[model samples]
Target: MRTFLTLFIALTLGLGWGLAARAEGFLGVYEDLPLAPGLTEVEGSGLSFDSPGGRIVEGYATGAVEAAEILKFYAATLPQLGWARDSDTLYRREAEVLKIDTEVDGGALAVHFTISPE
Candidate 1:
């Protein structure tokens, strides 16, 4: 009984931690937004606000990965999160729009993400 209790507690804690980590967003910018793998958030580049209209957010991330890979990641991931692709780099969900843009920076790709009221 003692061994079973300890195992149960450990499993519960481990599951909670795993869920929290999975739900965390890039740079802590937006709670519901997902970050692409192999990218790191740009320091001091996140912006977020809530106005009467709605919420707005912007942030940047950089990675050594190819632009196509990043695009593919979002393309496959965003729709599952309720965002419908509006274009190659734009997505929409309910009352907001999410746009993704990338630029080559010193052999790395700099990704700019913006969320605004639709």
Candidate 2:
């Protein structure tokens, strides 16, 4: 069952390595920012930190999802997830991490993050 779930997610959401895959109960505990719907993680695009401060996820959106929509989703949702958006940077008060999203392609939003404990 675990293998199936992993395979399903890999096929459906690309090679993801987030909290959802490790601890379902923890959910967003590890992944401070959520990936937009239909976005699949590009292979070799996952990065994490030993300290609870940094993680980066890169992926492309499937279907006809536009970049604007994806940006809107993050703009609206990040705050609800305890992130403060100052210009293009997202600072998580609760997590102490900084996150920024950029477009690598027309439908791809690459989220770059780093831990800032201070």
Candidate 3:
């Protein structure tokens, strides 16, 4: 049991560190998106950065890979990052897009996106 406990703690710490490491600008923002339910499309307002502004996209869904913006936000914001789709679990969301249970192909949350340095 000691070994198992040690492994568990290590795994937990690793996961936290991973999340923190990925937490930059928008990626960190996306990570904090709430998961509730009754979502169909993206919602949110834009902000200023360059000339016009960057619109904060928000989408709501329950247990389905609906919007790609939320995941893409992290993927594009992170280096060589991307998200997957979760067809196995149902997700409910509120406020921002919730990166739900995604396949472990890349990251824990199937973000379903691509990171571009542009």
Most accurate candidate by TM-score: 1
How many steric overlaps does candidate 2 have?
A: 1
What digit string (tens of lDDT, one per residue) describes model 2 on residues 1-118?
Answer: 4365435545433444442332112113233345566454444544544545433333322324555765666666556545677654556554465555555555545544444554
TM-score of each: 0.76, 0.49, 0.19
How would the candidate models be sorted by lDDT, starting from the highest? 1, 2, 3
Off by over 4 Å in 1: 1-27
Q: Per-residue lDDT for 1-118 in model 3, tens only? A: 4365335434534576444233322322243332322222223321212223322433332234334543443343222222232332322222212223333333222332211111
The candidate 1 region of ten consecutive residues with least summed lDDT is 17-26
Q: What TM-score quantifies how close candidate 3 is to the native fold?
A: 0.19
lDDT of 1 by residue, 7-112 (tens): 5434534676432233224446775566777688887889999989999999899989899988877887667566899887999988999999999999999999
All models: lDDT?
A: 0.76, 0.47, 0.31
The residue pairs in collision within model 2 are 53-115
Which has the better lDDT: candidate 1, or candidate 2? 1
Candidate 1 residue 88 Cα shift, in angstroms, is 2.0
Model 3: residues with Cα > 4 Å off, grouped in runs: 1-16, 26-31, 34-85, 88-90, 93-118
